[model samples]
Target: MRKVILSGMLCCALTATFTIDAVAANSALVSPDRRISVALFIDAHDQAQYQISHDRQPVLLASGLGLALSDRQFLNNIRSIKPSDITEINEHYQLYSGKQSQVDYSANQQQFVLTNDKMQQLEITFRVSNDGVAFRYRALEDKRIDKQSPKPVSVVEEYTRFNLPQQSRAWLQPIAEAQTGWEHTNPSYEEHYQMDIPVDQPSTSPAGWVFPALFKIGNKTDNTWMAITEAGVTANDHASRLQARSPKGEYAIGLPMAAEVFTGKALLSHDTLPLQTPWRVIAIGSLATIADSTLGTDLAEPSAMDTRFIKPGIASWSWGLLKDDATVYSVQQQFIDHAADMHWQYTLIDADWDQKIGDDKLKQLVDYAAGKNVGIWVWYNSSGAWNTTKYSPKSRLLTAETRQQEFAKLHNLGVKGVKIDFFAGDGQSMMAYYHDILNDAAKYELLVNFHGTTLPRGLSRTYPNLLSAEAVKGFEMITFFQEAADKEASHSAMLPFTRNLFDPMDFTPTTFNDIPNIKRKTTNAFELALPILFVSGIQHIVETPAGMKTVPTFVKSVMQQLPTHWDESRFIAGYPSKLAVFARRAGDTWFVAGINGEAEAKTITLDLSFLQTMGGNIEMIVSDGERGFQTHKVVLSAKTEIKLQGNDGFIIRITPKS
Candidate 1:
């Protein structure tokens, strides 16, 4: 047995374990593996702050933590702090759809009770894991702190700040101005990332930067990376973003815009006692550790509903390439046939389905898809004065009664899922709106795909029916303009380390054929690699039937056999916004994908040693020259050297020797 110190002088005994000792003014918490450590203390101004270090090296230095309630401030004039005894957490869980199917979560948790000069108390809980640190604020149930009954309080603002080193480089996307973009659908988390810039650099948009922000400390030699994001957001609270102005590289949390509400409903978070904020997660360590960490889902509440209805597979989409003209019955039927031909699972019919192909015709198309062993996913415009876009099926899902009615109609029509698009923002009301939809959709067993929406923030784990969300600047944007197409190579490379790091992104990637007017920069091989590179439960392929017919037979076969759910995933090599190579395994087969986003060629030593023991054959596909495909069959020993040209990509499939 081991002795552990708690509070100021209290002591307890437990089985031998690893834990940090702390008392009163200064409290330290270390991870189970003793790799990551956190220090919580009160600054000279009596403000609560925390710092983090990995392997004894500083990752985040002196970050502020507190809240500004409508009744009183909770950040300064701290009178006392009581640290709780460290608790150990070790558990295993399975996911229906994610980067990895099996997850083993282990962490050390502790709570700090802080009382200000007013004698009012606030509680902050910290959970330290080997991958990173996660913390959240809560209201205590102690009656001594407040004599009267607990009244509902409003969270005016959060004082949490992430202080990054000035030397660190960042890859962050600027948050869009709410209700400002086309059709007032801005703040949908679709802006291009400001890649590899200084941490102190001000954001282009005054609204600030979006979550899952990636930062590289020191130099390339150091190879230290840290990504900041939030998880477990509930209806009781609002989603948050980093402020635009980072004074001395310290990013403070910012609330949603004034116009971001649910039909002009509640904006600020208002709740009674026994309230808990979302977990502020910081993933720190090497690029591999950051990429492999499942802290986003680990900290989330477990699934309460049965997930037997959730299916992970590829989808054939018509809207991205064919635009509004493709929402007709004939086009949707063709895509359904295309999905059947590719052995895909679903076909998404986007925008104005109600008008373009009336309800009768849509039902007919759904029946036709069912005949072809394909499921139909119809689109909806989740708008009600939040956005002015005139997409049909709009205003039909704003309320629970109407939303469930629409879902029942779709279920009766044999539709498999609904793609809800164009949400306003991340206010408290909007967050609750999302929860309401997910809860209602689960009742009908309808899979949800959120387009023109915010980052998922681990919603898929809680609501397994939520398959994919289009929070990134996806494939549709490439067809709209030349500028967006030009940035595809670099932007795609940054995703695995940022936006797509912990959530399913409906980027609707891949189009082997040409866009109507834009000059597509990335080669066919690059397009082919995306289905395996990106992890989306329902991957909506943008390529049309004609486009699919144009690719090589082997390429079609590869697309047909792609896996949406993975058993495991490992980072192979490369950097953000430049090159990315990853290996994902599904069952006995492994899919290795790599992309080079730069104008020049790059060479990296690939590590396939893990597969050597299994004794497999490597079937590789890469750009033949440019805008072409080439296949190679090789055997690996331990390591292999591969080179990729400008705007190029490659995919390798490892199968057991036959």
Candidate 2:
């Protein structure tokens, strides 16, 4: 029979006892052969619905928490559920039916266990080590529901709900505020708007799916209980509303409880509990590195994967993207010819080299690039159908499988890397897709450069092949967009504090002497200093081949000498969006770049204390003032102090004089 239970007992001062009376909800229902038990209790007196009841009988407030259940439906045709499956466990811990009883708690503090006459069992745990408490519950071995699916699988669904203490209004309010913030800033704007339900009248509100809300209890002054469903389930209907019983004797329905579930066998299935109350789980480090690393590091000490996979180089497109294929090929050859002269390791062939995916055209370019002792990196689209009417349909590697194969083919062709583009940050699904791409590319030993994508997040640590991500509003726009030049100074200063915290950023440094607009600032010398200023594994010396040939002697000298790897880094001065100074080390040499956003000059002294520890005579390469971004390169002797002007910058590379 379907029975509802109510139990309670009061402790003198520190402890409380709870006894539940099993009341039949439906007498005709038979108890399942195997059942899982889950329960929650509210102890705080401040909550509006601090306690729960059945048929006017007060249920036991075993702990300061509550329980609720959601009915999950299983779809027939789905295959393996990868990490991308968010529909079931949006952000809450989901318990899948399994024989394992070992519970793994996300945040466990206190523990409670109860079993009823029908073999129904419940386990509840709370963690309160930090400022807040986390409650988790698991109901096991419920009657299995049978469903006919195209694939063979067992389906089990249970009635899930939380048991809360009486008088829980104050504790519930902050939960409402946190939920509001979560919904407001949710990545899926439409989903957030649709999921918003009126707390008092959820029935009349528009029913649309949104992420589940966290259940809360207790007042801020004493303690607060917080609980969130693991990721997967969506809140779509009024069926998920939060029900509350008032302190005096009133019952009201609140907003729906947020919930998530997991369907695959790989998901762990145990109800977890903690020995204490209030616990904190923090994932720290650079957000960019986390974004880039498919396999995220522990919250602390996040770093890029080993640099052994990185083959430092210069690319052609970054130096110059030409309309004429022959000119581009000739320029590439010339760059290769001077590779030893400039200390560059690689040359890239941008888009349009391949007439088709398996065409001999790419093969020819690969052969030529290899003969020059330079590595070749080709470009490809993230996803797009090639148009034969406009270009060559045979050239497209459209599907994921096809792209994977093409990457392998490129690797076989001795292409060192591939540049991928046009990945708009769609949602969690797209994020998963990108992660898969990076993993697959790893198998082929292909270095990856992501263009037109979101900011990096140290994914390079997990996949060192992921060389750089281009999310900056950078120099490319300067030639066509007038606003680009105006914003360049400020944007450069802002990135180090914001984006660079994660991983290598592909800013495509050193665009000098090629500014189309005279009113704007751009020059060869400015470009020469950029490699030392920007921290990217793949440093691009972007300029026309003709421009490179025409570049001033001093500017060329600087470009040829800049180093890509660094041993140390320091932030010397300035605001995020104004002016800034940074010094990075590569062995005994140190490279410093200071940028000024305004048009006014400012003087600053170098803190060579770091160098003093190393004890060395510093040889300097200083490019400051308008000359910093000018085509004509100028250098000054080592000095204790340096002065720079607005909309200007400085790049200094110092090595110990032997």
Report clashes for each candidate as comma-separated counts: 0, 96
Q: What lDDT does each candidate get?
A: 0.85, 0.42
Write the residue-wise lDDT of candidate 1 on 317-398 in tens digits: 8888888888888778889999999999999988888988988998899889889989999999988988899988899999
Model 1 residue 197 CA deviation (Å) reads 1.1
TM-score of each: 0.95, 0.55
Candidate 2 global CA lDDT score: 0.42
Best by TM-score: 1
Each candidate: RMSD to true structure? 4.0, 15.1
The 10 consecutive residues of candidate 2 with the worst lDDT sum are 92-101
Q: Write the per-residue lDDT of candidate 2 for residues 1-658, one digit (tens) a residue.
A: 1112222221111134433323222210111211111223222231111122222233223322223323222121111111110011111111110001111222213334433333333443323221122233443343433222222221122222334443332111112211122222111111111111122222222222211222223222322222222211111111122233333312222332222111111111212121111111111112221111111111111223444555645554533433335435555566555554566766666655564323465576678767766777777655332111222222344446876788788788888887775542322333444566776777777788876554343355445576776655555655546766766676665555434433466777665554655346532333454566566667666665556666556567666766656555666665445666777676677766777655566677766565555545444444444444343222332334766656666676566768
